[model samples]
Target: MYRTWRFATGCNDACAIDDYRDICPVFFFGGIHSKKGFFMGIVRKPSVTPPSSRSPVDATPSRTRPGSATFGDGPAVKIFRPDTDQAQVEVPRQSAAADSMITVSSMPSAQILPMHPMAGSLARYSLRAPANLPAANALGLRVFKSRNYVDIAPGEIVLVRETGTAGEYRAALVSELVALGPVLFYHPLSKTWTLERPHPLPEPGKVIDIDIDQLVRKVRKEHAQKHRVHTGNDDSFEYSAAQEGALVARGLKQFPPEQAAIIRSELQAVESIFADAGHAIGQNYKDADAVYESFFGVDHHAVAQRFADSVARGQALSSEYQGTWGDEKFVGVDADSNSAAWMYKRDFHGRFFINRKYMQRGVLSISLGHEMLHTNRIDRFQTIGPNAADYFYLDSRLGRLLNWDTLADYDVPERSVSDAIMRGGLTVEYLNAFTNDHDNFLFGVSDYLGIGDDLPLQTAVDLFNANPSLRAHLAVNNADSLVYAAKSMQTLHQSKTEYAWLDSLIDD
Candidate 1:
């Protein structure tokens, strides 16, 4: 079926489609929620497939825009084209032999209005998902990739709302982070896009008139000015790699003088491992391999071989990890979000779970940190070497993460559940810091690296690297503080949930 939509006079936007190939959400029969009132009609979600080689999924609108709707409701939405005063389009129908044939022979030409200052600018950015019906869908666009996401910081857009030569809306952004209004509406008086909450009442002509080309150029100019420093740190970053290494090397020789020493003490705290398998085999897996290979000269093959050997010797138990962190958010949107200690639990939980996703691996993975909090049998803590998290923690920095002024800090590991991740980022950083060959062997020895609960090992590795990468990316635009603040101010689990163990890993 063919359809055409025309903008009313004083408006210049125009779109018409030759083919209405049905898939989903796009060009489908659905109801639309409008400020004026709910209506059903013959409407469509249309876009030109990639001009060149991109696949259909790639061509699909990467992000949901302001007027985008699910396109599935009580009945097919009739053709709609916003006019200067009314936000409606009429479809004509004529009855014939019990079957009605509807056709509109004429479409009024959309008047060519003077272009706005921000027209054709594909300069793009992102907006946080609002608490609206379509908000969940904001995550589905290919850009999120769900886990392997880059900086969600402002200027880093996953996808742009392009003027697909078909849609009435044309929006995109470039590199520079400039004026962005997720809820932008056209200001008839100013003739420029403004960052204001769109009015609730039905005032169609006075609302947003996005120019994809304009935004594209604007963002580029803005991002160019921001990227000068290179390092994600805007305050002038100067770090001595040598100094960081020397700090760890200094403590290399220290050990508790006891049979049940720091390492053994940690091993004694064994909890069941919760290994989660993931669909991703992308940068996350590559990063883990890279981090391990660069520092310790170890790769996936070696790790796999060792796990095999450990299994052959009965030293390691293989099991699949479970759970999905997708539906999971840093903060709950419902009454749960209203909890008295919402911020603390939500913030830390997101980071903890995110880092866990970073650490995910193919084989049996565990939370080495969580297993260290509760040791059921004192006699069982003697094992070390491959397939044991204890070996990794024996002389490594991971031990530093399990600290407490009071003995209550002992329970932090046990609290590393799905809903709450405790000190997860710190744990990952400590593990990553142990990238030295000696440190790697000390911490990365276990096949079934003991993580009793929450995200599997690979997940942690992914999030661990993901954050720093994101931080660095945002440092370009000075939004690093926004990301950091969100990641920080979080508790081990809940707000009342204090760190249950010692504050330092170095035993006195």
Candidate 2:
């Protein structure tokens, strides 16, 4: 007998191939092991009416219980604790209910499987038993005798049909395990297939009965769907792209008019950064935010709120260097930079802390876009693949929540992967352009230096893409370049005619 309790606890144990008994229990059917040799047996035939508190072996309609459904060939299984003989079963009766049921079969004690000694020795190691066994058994929610398992977690969205609703399917959220069986709660959502919720769902309440088989089927179908790139259906791609564009637009609209306009003007520049990054991985983007959502979901409001909250909390911290990083401004590295240990402190509790000063500089959307793109994405890592050297390198950074390291011990493939991610090479280029823009006080002198805003950034990206040991000195610290510009301007100031021409250029 497979111990299904591990599924409920989310145990992470590995079994050696030789120990078949120690293999983790597969979460096939709900509650009881789908395999034979159950402590007590119940064979249930499909029934429409609600089950009542009745004996497992001889379950017949009891007139005392009004509106009780008869279990013709089916018998009720008693739910019992190992220390007790049996417990009172409470099978709620409903006039129109899609009552779920559990099925188990009797087996000799000698045939019952024993738990692994190590696992059994743990404290409070209760035997796998559902709290709502009586209801589950009556409702015909039992594991199928099969070699398959589908593990569903609480708070996950699932497709479920309500009891007595004539097979009307809607999205339901898995609440918890009652009697070691799944309990689903109905939500008001019409389309429940996605995990993304535009707004928060109300707390899990409103218990509902559902077909476990149908739930498993929905999970299996969606699991398959997640792996395949949606093709031959321009509708899905078009819808997703349009939805993402609207989400970004909405995010932009939330800002003040002047600030929003500044952000809007920078959208094309920001989109170019993402487009160039996507080109590295052969991904074509119709909309920058669409590609962004493909990595992060279409939940812009939540991420923005989270960013705001992080900034607020970070400001509350007692640190002198709370939001001051002059180096970051020089090199287009945002607070998401992983260049030095000091920069790590800018992130409080996995979120970047932005100083209000930065926002007032009209780079609020730019910073938001940078942080949002840096958000962890499992799909992105999967696309990088395990065999790829950059996979482990990228994993180390993302797992550490460092986003991207501008001066990370650079490598060819690592640079490729980094360039493809918004936080990587794209960050270097975009930040330089934004920081050195004529309107930005910080680093704006770069635009006046004759050397283009992106020249240093491009050189850094190219160096990292080719040489592993090369540090991003030029990109990370443009102090020398700034010095050159200052001295050159000072020299021009000494020449009357030259200074007049240079002063005219500044006015222009």
Q: Compared with the true structure, what per-residue lDDT tens digits does model 2 show for residues 75-149?
A: 222221111121212233434433345443332111112433322211111122323232112222222231111
| TM-score of candidate 1 against the unseen true structure | 0.16
Best by lDDT: 2
C-alpha positional error of residue 363 in candidate 1 after TM-score superposition, expressed in Å: 33
RMSD of each: 31.4, 33.4
Error in Å for residue 377 of model 1: 38
TM-score of 2: 0.18
Model 1, position 315, has a per-residue lDDT of 18
lDDT of 2: 0.24
Local lDDT at 64 for model 1: 18
